[model samples]
Target: MHSDRGGQYCGNVYRQLLHDHQTVRSQSRRGDCYDNAQAESLWSRLKTEVLEVRERPVFADLADAQRSVADYFDYYNHERRHSRIDYQTMYHSHQQLTTLSTLNCPA
Candidate 1:
């Protein structure tokens, strides 16, 4: 997983957790926005296309807002077309990963 050099990410506990999962942690260099541009872009799109368009929300209503945004993310991953991913949904990309799992096997 990729993360900034935040305190939470730099903690020994966090590093151990990732090590347990055999994850190769990639940390962005300090003051390098370009290192995390893709994440920044995604958040920007979500905020502009979803959050900014919504009416002012109450703190008590935060859960509902988060849920709505989560749903939109699902739709974007599974339905929306993107030239970068060759117009395939993220869901489709995941399916491609397990295509070999569907190979002929005895019942």
Candidate 2:
């Protein structure tokens, strides 16, 4: 439910739909650019990297679109870098978890 403070993003119909599904709405604070900056960054990356690819961005089937989105999510979680986490990709963080555990182990 986290989104920018835009009227069209969670307009009346969308709000009603969420209400029907019993979901809470959360929005960024007004006039604060960084409040929901992470969500904005993810959306920008999805559109630019997944939807606007060079080999034409139209999907002829629902499964294709779903697969494409899934692939992007996998890449985002595994390969993408985040500065907040010392510029380490998520894949590396998970890998380093076992490394740290092994170092701390007695045997």
Candidate 3:
């Protein structure tokens, strides 16, 4: 996973976990603060579009919160148009990429 220079991510336990799972660890170069800009922007949009638009603005429980977030993600990938991807839904863009990759794959 990708993260900034944090003590929790640097510990031996976290490193061992990643190694055990064969997951590549990505970290920002020292003194580079904008590594998480994309993630931060996504979170800002989620908060604004999902949580802030709710009537109560709070979930009744953990399950409720999870379901709400899951629904939001479904809408985000399927229905929402993003300017970054030429105003196409994430799901559509993913489908196009998958099709292109499959066509380009060599036997």
Candidate 4:
């Protein structure tokens, strides 16, 4: 997984967790903040569109937060139309790309 060089990500416990899961850790080079801009933008949208939409703006627990985020991502990938991809949902665009790639591959 990719993340910034924050203390939490740099901690031994976090590194061990990634290692145990066999996930590679990728971090932006020092002094280069643009590397993570896309992820940061997604997080900004998630907080604004999901968390701030509620009056309380806080989840009851970890599971609730996870479920809410999962639901938002489901809507984002399958239901929401994005202008950047000719107004297609992300899932639709991804499927189209996958189909195109499969068709173009050599037999």
Candidate 5:
């Protein structure tokens, strides 16, 4: 639901898809570049890892591209170690947070 104020996000096709799913639309305040930094960073990494290394970044088909991107994200979330979180894997961090939250809840 969170995105920059891009034209496509405000367009009918995208709005309709969100409406159909009953999701709220949220956008960053105009002119706030920092609000989108995380997404931009991810895009930069994806392009560098999968697209920019090759001369022709085009895939044989759309599904191939989707699969490649999905695989990259899966690896990023489940396997890649992040120095920001004491070099822990993202999956472990998420599990720890989940366990902490569950323990904090009343029986």
Candidate 6:
């Protein structure tokens, strides 16, 4: 389900795209910003932790910045620990998924 309060979601083009995919679109009530807190919080953390102190980039520099951000994301997923996620990196979460699957499989 795609969740957003953007006006583009209400347009015929977007609705048509969803219909083609047989997807359901869920929208929060208008003027309600807190409904998308998870997404907004992520953006806030990304900006404050990764982008806010960085030097502004020119058009050509954008590619380099994007590459750096991608690299950071890899490190973030594999190295950084999160308190809310039991102090484990996102990589640990994937390991848990596979471990459970292996243990549950029939011999």
Mark the regions of model 2 whose C-alpha exceeds 4 Å error after superposition: 91-107
Question: What's the lDDT for all of these models?
Answer: 0.82, 0.83, 0.90, 0.91, 0.88, 0.79
The C-alpha stretches of model 5 lying farther than 4 A from their native spots are 20-23, 31-34
On TM-score, the leading prediction is 4
Per-residue lDDT tens digits for candidate 6, residues 6-106, read 77988999999999999988988788878888667666766777777676652247687788678767877898787877999889987998899999999
- Poorly placed runs, candidate 1 (over 4 Å): 6-26, 31-34, 58-60, 97-107
What lDDT score goes with residue 70 in model 3?
92
Residue-pair clashes per candidate, as listed? 0, 0, 0, 0, 0, 0
Model 3 spans with C-alpha error above 4 angstroms? 6-25, 31-34, 55-57
Q: Write the per-residue lDDT of candidate 2 for residues 49-70, one digit (tens) a residue.
A: 8777746547868999899889
lDDT of 3: 0.90
Sorted on lDDT, best first, the list reads 4, 3, 5, 2, 1, 6
TM-score for each predicted model, relative to the true structure: 0.59, 0.71, 0.71, 0.82, 0.78, 0.61
lDDT of 5 by residue, 15-98 (tens): 999999999999888999999887887788788887887566567789988998999899888888878778998889999999
Model 6 score (lDDT): 0.79
Query: Which 10-residue span in candidate 6 carries the lowest summed lDDT?
Result: 53-62
lDDT at position 42, candidate 5: 77
C-alpha displacement of 19 in model 4, angstroms? Answer: 1.9
Residue range 1-107, candidate 1, lDDT tens digits: 99988899999999999999999999999998799887877788788878787776622477886788798889878897767778898789778767756765455
lDDT of 2 at 26: 89
TM-score head-to-head 4 vs 6, winner:
4
Give Cα distance to truth, residue 106, candidate 4, Å. Answer: 2.0
lDDT measured at residue 93 in model 5 versus the true structure, 0 to 100: 94
